[model samples]
Target: MELTRLKKKLVTAVKGHKLLKDKRDELMRQFLDLVRENMALRQKVEAGILSANKNFVIAKAGMSEQILNTALMSPKQEVYLEAGKKNVMSVDIPVFETKTRTADANDVYSYGFAFTSGDLDGAVKSLADILPDMLRLAEVEKSCQLMASEIEKTRRRVNALEHVIIPETQQNIKYITMKLDENERSTQIRLMKVKDMMLEEAHHYKEKEVMVE
Candidate 1:
């Protein structure tokens, strides 16, 4: 009975190992895709920031520090960031949403046009345009990290089932089966010896009865 139970457990372990392996493979594939996307988005965000900084530098060079600081002192635009979760392959990844307080495209310009240079406007626009991409990059980066962690966990489970549980169960079943076969052979040998003794006694009794007659 114990052997039968172990065999059943072995079957279950094998199936679970296969499933975990499949999950790990799928996670790896998606992880790699996310990694690529993350790299691309990082590059895009970096480039956009660099360009925006260059615009800001040009704008600063053109105007006095006091005027530029005064112009940017008050910002009309307000950004709302909403963070949420998305499930993918059993991993909960982050989802980020961005919304502006006002729909007006010009709301990004905090200062009046009369006071601000065109270069400042260009810089602000650049930063505003890259906001969504930056959020997307963040989301993808977080997803990649989560999927990588899940993949590692799945891999460990698969390895444990494949290398440890199934093999031990099979070995145990083999040992039990060998011992049962030995016991059955011993019982058969003992039964044959008893049958021979009974036959010999019956022959001896018949001889004694004939002699008395």
Candidate 2:
């Protein structure tokens, strides 16, 4: 290729490399934030589940099987959840919204207070409260997985541009420039040689004229 065209391509490659680096950095920042959120959500979910399980076991030991079954048969409250999406760095992360059917906290205990143990109430309440967080946990985890995949793909592209494409373009430009400069120098040398030969021939012709005189 010509030196001018090679230089133009090199400039374009450099610009592309810069843009990809910026995109990679922004993606890394977003990914890190999601990672932190995922970590916190995981810990909260685990602790909450453990506490709820402990309460459930205590309740089970205290209550008779028939009483426990009656208490669990009908739920006092219902929750409606809808999932949507939000964009983060061009990725669509899930958004979950929970709508509770019952507004009063007292309605959470559907079973009669006289038959069920306090431990059972505590367990039921813990599970209900954690449901939203559990949904949030699902959202964050899925987002993390998606972001990690995108990051990996972007990293590969950035590496290819930085390590391979840009370097190869620069080398090609250098090679073309050197060839053009060499051609220019060779043309200049040939012109000088031709001019010197013309002067030598003219001088001999002038001496012949002087001899004739």
Candidate 3:
């Protein structure tokens, strides 16, 4: 007893469902990519941290043996940070690159000591100490990039479901319901007419028989 309008609405809803499914697939693909990137960045950060720890231990040992702090210490030098913006899936994150002089307080060496033997080792070790932090920054930046991309993607999907997909489905349902109602009404009217015609014919037959008799 479905009406034409209702049938058309069902067809529309099917089309909308297909479209939403495609959108969901695309969002999932993007999400997976971001997750992979995040994992890789995390591994890199962990490695950097391990390396930095090793460097710190070596530096501490060297400093203890040399007693070079008073004689080798130099004035603090400026460290400049230059950050660049990167966009991943419409998420902007700042990636910092450091520009600093190689010279450090520990870089100065006594005349008799080899250039790479004592304080220079300490300077290199200090750089290693900062390496972990630098890697951490990198990790944070990558994570932010990944998260932002995912958020935007999720937002779009949610919007599509709420505003477009769900509404379209409901619209189709409404149309189909109306069509079915109209069809039912028409069917009932036709059935009533048929019933009335059958009754009238029966009455005529009975009158004819009675007259003949």
Candidate 4:
């Protein structure tokens, strides 16, 4: 009975190990995809920021410091960001939405065109255009972190079952089965010797009866 139970446990451990391995593989695939996307998005965000910085530098060179500060002091536009979550393979991925307060394209510009240089306008436009991509980059980065953590946890569980639980259970079952077989052989040998002794005693008794007659 103990051997049977151990065999069942071994089967369960093997099956669980397989399932965890599959999950780990799928998680790895997803993680790699996220990593690729994160790389591309990081490049895009970096380029956009660089371009915006260059435009700002040109605009600053063309204007007085007081004028530049005044031009950017007041904001005509506002953005609302909403956050939510998406569940993927037991991981929660973040979803972000950006909503501009005003639909007017000109709302992004805080200063009148008469006071600001074209370079300032270009810089502002570049920032606005890259906003969504920046947010997306953040989302992808967070997802990658979360997925990586989950993958590690899954890997540990798989290793425990495959390397520890399953092997130990199998070894226990083999030990118990060998012992049971040895006990069965010993019992059979003892019974056979007892039967031979009984037959010899009966033959001796029969011979004595014949002599007495």
Cα lDDT for residue 133, candidate 1: 90
TM-score of candidate 3 versus the correct structure, residues matched by position: 0.47
Comparing 1 and 2 on lDDT, the stronger one: 1
Q: After superposition, how far is residue 101 of candidate 2 from its true place, in Å?
A: 2.1
Residue pairs in clash, model 3 = 3-179, 3-180, 6-176
Q: Write the per-residue lDDT of candidate 3 for residues 113-164, one digit (tens) a residue.
A: 4433443454555555555466545756575556556666656766775678
lDDT of each: 0.90, 0.86, 0.61, 0.93
Please tell me which predicted candidate would have the highest lDDT against the true structure: 4
Worst 10 residues of 2 by lDDT: 1-10
Which 10 successive residues of model 1 have the least lDDT summed?
104-113
Give the per-residue lDDT of model 2 (tens digit) for 126-199.
88878777998999899988888878887898888789987887898788778889999999999999999999
- For model 2, how many clashes? 0
- What TM-scores do the predictions have? 0.91, 0.89, 0.47, 0.91
After superposition, which runs of candidate 1 have C-alpha atoms over 4 Å from their true positions?
Answer: 206-213
Model 2 bad stretches (over 4 Å): 210-213
lDDT tens per residue, model 4, 18-132: 9899999999999999999999999999999999999999999999999999999998889999999999888999999888998876679888889779999999999988888
